[model samples]
Structure formats: structure tokens, C-alpha cells
Target: MRVMVLVKATEDSEKGFFRDPATIEMMEAMGRFNDELRDAGILLTGDGLKPSSEGKRIAFDGAGRTVIDGPFAATRELVAGFWLWDVKDVDEAVAWVKRCPNPMPGPSEIEIRPLYEAGDLQ
Candidate 1:
């Protein structure tokens, strides 16, 4: 099975909390965790994202499409980063997430969802 792990953005993340001096420890911890995932052959890809101000949104309605600039509202709903992993099942993904270090300085959340495999449609 494959899964996408979503790292939800927090207010601090939107403000580039990773740039803060105090976050060095957190970064190191995350690096170690990432290494663990890679060593276990579960991690396919992962990376953190820049703030929403640097992004754009494409909204579609009927045959029309509108391009909206970012610095979007709803901080908690935005994704700060993601990981694509090949695992045995959602339970395995959950177990890995449970072992992860907090991605935010104050509060944070990581969501795990299974990817639709080709066999799923059959």
C-alpha cells in the first residue's frame, strides 16, 4: 500500500517557524526520523514547503478557472509538507506517524491517508 502523509501548517509554520533559532533541535530530530523512515525503506519522498505567500491556487468552476494568489487564509487547513510512503497498510502508517517528532514548535498535526491503488478500482 501507498500513503500520503500530510503535515498540516500551523500559524508558526506560515510565519516560517523553521527559520527560528530554537527550531534547530526540532530540525535535527526530524532529520533523524526521516533517516529512520528511509533506512526502513518506507519513505519514497518528502519535503517541507515554503509559506503560502509563495504559492498560488487555481479555482475551477464549470468551464471557468480563476487563479488566486496565496497568503491564503485558514492556516490550519493548509499543508506545510508531505511524504509519500509505501507501507503494508494504514495501520503501519499510523505506527510510523506515532513515532514522529512534532513538526511544529508549539502544536502540530500529521494526517495519513491511503492512496488509491490500481487494483482498488478493479
Candidate 2:
């Protein structure tokens, strides 16, 4: 199965905390973790995102589409980064997440969700 592992954004992440000198160790740790995933042939693609302030949102309703600027209000609701991984099952993905370094300066969350294959629609 394929899974998208989302690294949920925190206030510190939204403010670019990972770029801080104090978090260098954490960044290094995360790099090592990614290398492990790649070495295992589990990693498909992954990268961290810039702050929401540099992003934009598009809202649609019926025939109308609205473009919203970012730095969105919700902190915990945002995604700071993500990994596209091909794993044997959700449990395997969960196991990988358990080994990930903390992506934030403080408490953070990583959500793993399975992607639906086209055959599911049959």
C-alpha cells in the first residue's frame, strides 16, 4: 500500500523553527531517518514545506472559485512536510513513523493515511 505521512505543523514550524541553529541536531537526525527509509527502498518522495505565509489556498463552491492568501489561521491544522512511502501495510507505515525524529521544537504530530488505489472504485 501507498501512504502519505504528514508531519503536522506547529507554531514553531510555521515560524521556521527547523532553520534555527539550536535545532541542528534534530534536523540531522531527521536526515538520517530519511536515509534509512531510502536505503530500505520505502521512500518515494518527501520534502519540508515553507511557511504558510508563502503559500496560498483555493476555495471552490459550486461554480465559484476563490483564491485565499495564506498564513492560514489554524496552526495544528497545517502540514509542515510529508513523505510518500510505499509500505506493506498501514501498520508498517506506523512503525516507520514511530522511528521518526520529532519534527518540531516542541510536541508535534505525524499522521499516516493510506491512499486509495483505482481498483477500489470497482
Candidate 3:
């Protein structure tokens, strides 16, 4: 099975806070986690994204179009990073995620979802 692990951004992330010592430590821990996944042959691909300010949002209303600049409050619901992994099952994926260290100080959330396989659509 394939899974996507989504890293969610916090308010400070959207605001582009400088990396403090604690934040640096957290990032190092995340790197180590990725290393572990790679060593285990589970990691397919992963990357951290830049702040929302560098992105754009588009909305379509019928034929008309609208665009919004980033640094959007909706960033709270947007993904800051993602990891693609191959695992045996949901339980295996959960166990791997449980072993990951927290990526940031305060309340950061990571969501794990299964990827749709060719067999799944049937």
C-alpha cells in the first residue's frame, strides 16, 4: 500500500517566523525520521514546502475567474509538506508515523492517508 503523510502549517509558519533553535532542532529530528524511513525502504518521496506567501490560489465561479494571493488564513488547512511511503497496511503506516518525532513546537498535526491504487477504483 501507498500512503501520503501531510504536514500541516501553523500560524507562525504562515507568517514566516525565523527558525529559532527549537525549530531547528525540530527540523533536524524530521530529517532523521526521513532517514529512518529511507533506511527501511519505505520512503518513496518527500519534501517540505515554502511558506504560503509563495503560493497562489485560484477560484472559478462559472465562466468568470478569481485569484487570491497567498499568506492566506486557509493555509491552516493547507499542507506544508508531504511524504510518500510504501507500507504493508494501514496499521504499518500508523506505526511508522507514531515513531516520528514532533515536527514543531506547540500543536502541529500530521495527517496520514492511503493513496488510491489501480485496484481501489474498481
lDDT of 3 by residue, 1-122 (tens): 99999989887666664778887888889899999999999999999888888888899999988988887776569888899999999899899989999865678888999999999899
> Order of all candidates by lDDT, from best down to worst?
1, 2, 3
Model 1 misplaced regions, further than 4 Å: none
- Lowest summed lDDT across 10 adjacent residues in model 2 is found at 13-22
Better of 1 and 3 by lDDT: 1
Please report how far candidate 1 places residue 76 from its true position, in Å: 0.8
The clash tally of candidate 1 reads 0
Give a tens-digit lDDT track for model 1, residues 11-106. 888887545677898888999999999999999999999999989999999999999999999999999999999999999999999999998988
lDDT of 2 by residue, 1-122 (tens): 89999999989888875456758988899999999999999999999998999899999999999999989998899999999999999999999999998888779999998999899779
Candidate 2 displacement at residue 84 in angstroms: 0.4
Error of 1 at 35 (Å): 0.5
**Where is model 3 more than 4 Å wrong at Cα?**
62-64
